[model samples]
Target: MNTVLVTGASAGFGEAICRKLIADGYKVIGAARREDKLKSLATELGDNFLPLQFDVTQKDAVDNILATLPIGFQQIDILINNAGLALGIEPAYEADYTDWETMVQTNIIGMMHLTRTILPGMVERNFGYIINLGSIAGTYPYRGGNVYGATKAFVKQFSANLRTDLFGKKIRVTNVEPGLCGGTEFSNVRFHGDNAKANDVYKNVQYITAEDIANTISWLVNTPPHMNVNSIEIMPIAQAPAGLNVSKEM
Candidate 1:
């Protein structure tokens, strides 16, 4: 079985992906900041799952942890960059600077760092797959989705550029962009722990579940080596881009 490395394995799409991959007989290195959650997952998954605890936002810690991968887990055939978050729902002018910074650091910088670290090995072996969790927010903008959307847009473009750079190589890069996904810590984190408000985001709506994304990743992994899925954007049927707003009496 090939070994796969997934970031943000503690919750949301990351957790679901881990479960699906392990079930399909793949050895997974699940990395997350929450050691306890990762430990629980490892316990449930048995020998196939190895838990590495570290915040992706911490560059030094990322390097140290990955550099010391044990002998059995050293070879990473696939990398799933699922460790991103949206901080706030306020417009740019009213948003916290720190929140914006956190999103950029984790969504863009951390993903790039981990990808860079893992690429050399893949290049040497001449085989690899890179899967990034982007968002439909990247393509469709909302009132308060400024920095978060921008970061995801970067993810989408970066994935495309990576494929171009790897032309002729067996390596594959895909950006999975999802919209209106629920059953994760996303809204809670964005709303800063306001559960009621967070809950409202999905109330009475049929939102996409983490399991849905997990299934998508599984399909990508099983796809033929010769085929490359450049980018996939998913959204709940109930959701669609809003029309342009105009001031009637300004």
Candidate 2:
């Protein structure tokens, strides 16, 4: 049985991935900071889903959980680094420094720590796949996406570097970059719980959904071992580059 471990599993892409994978017959461990939500998911998903509650920012917590994983959930063959957030859309000069720091701690530090802890096992077993959730913000920069974009850019590069390090091994690493996705808490959290502002961003827009991402992940894992997909950058047809920025009277 293929066992997978997903971070940020309480909601959004992580929740969707867990739900989809379980339906496809993969055993899954869903880790998140929200204990209540995780437990609720456990109740809903039954024995195949193991809800792990711990803050990814806490290295010790990650270490503890991995050390105590139950029988079916212990050997994780796939790792999805999906527990990331964008705090605000403010420009760097006017953005919250605290928000930037939090983004780094979660998007970069937390993710890196978890991957490092899981990799050795994969190496020993000679089988593993890591799919990181990146954003198009990382490649196409918007004015206010400074730190969040940079963090995802890091994910892009890091996943490539990991594949380089694991060359000649059966392990695989892929970075899944998504653009303009809605139907989740991403915008709500990014806007700091301002539903109106969040709603406005997706008003009548046909953007990607959490299920779309989960389905992509499902395809990645099922691909043949001889093949490796380095990265996939996806944006809805309704979204595209805004072209050059200009100031006629600045």
Candidate 3:
């Protein structure tokens, strides 16, 4: 069975991807910071699902998790870097430096550390897939998304560079960018636990769901080996590019 490792497996696109991959017959290693959520997913998905608990921000913990994969789960055919978040929606001038730091650490540093750890093995194997979760904010910037957008832009560039570097190695790197996704903890976390505020962010707009992103990842992974889907940008119908006003009076 092909084994895939997914970070941020507790909820949102991560959880949905884990479920979809399991259903598609891949041995899945679901990694998340929340132990309870991981356990719940393992129970729900049965034997093929392995729940690993670790904070991606913790470099030592990430190293340990990658180093100690059980013999049966040793082969990692796919690595999905999905553990990332936007802490606060504040313009650069008014944004808290702490929030900026958190975004940088998780979205950029953590991702780099994990990719560095796993990529050598993939190179050695000469066949593996790496999917990085990015955002439309990376391509189109907006108010209150200063540092968050910058971080995702880093993801976009990094994924592209990886694909270029691995051109002849049969290692595929894909960047999946999604826009206006609801039904995830993203807005809630961005609002610092203000559920009402989070709800208001998407109140009028029809947003994409976690399952939608998960399905896209599944499709990318299932594509023929020779076909490498380099990048995909997904947006909800109700949303458009940055600075585009969709709610203007008719």
The most accurate candidate by TM-score is 1
Instruction: Please give the ranking of all candidate structures by TM-score, highest first, separated by commas.
Output: 1, 2, 3
Candidate 2 residues 12-86, lDDT tens each? 999999999999999999999999999998999989999999899999978987999987778989999999999
lDDT minimum window of 10 residues, candidate 2:
65-74
Which parts of model 3 have CA positions greater than 4 angstroms off? 242-250
- Cα displacement (angstroms), candidate 3, residue 89, comes to 1.0
Each candidate's TM vs. the true structure?
0.98, 0.98, 0.96
lDDT per residue (tens digit) for residues 192-217 in model 3? 99999999989988899999999999
Clashing pairs in 2: none
Name the top lDDT candidate.
Answer: 1
Q: Please, what is the whole-model Cα lDDT of each candidate in the order they appear?
A: 0.95, 0.94, 0.93
Give each model's clash number: 0, 0, 0
lDDT digits (tens) for residues 1-250 of candidate 1: 8899999999999999999999999999999999999999999999999999998889898899888999889989999999999999998899999999999999999999999999989999999999999999999999899999999999999999999999989899999999999999999999999999999999999999999999999999999999999999889998988889898988
Q: What residue runs in model 2 are displaced by over 4 Å at the alpha carbon? A: none
Which candidate model has the greater lDDT, 2 or 3?
2
- Model 2 per-residue lDDT at 205: 92
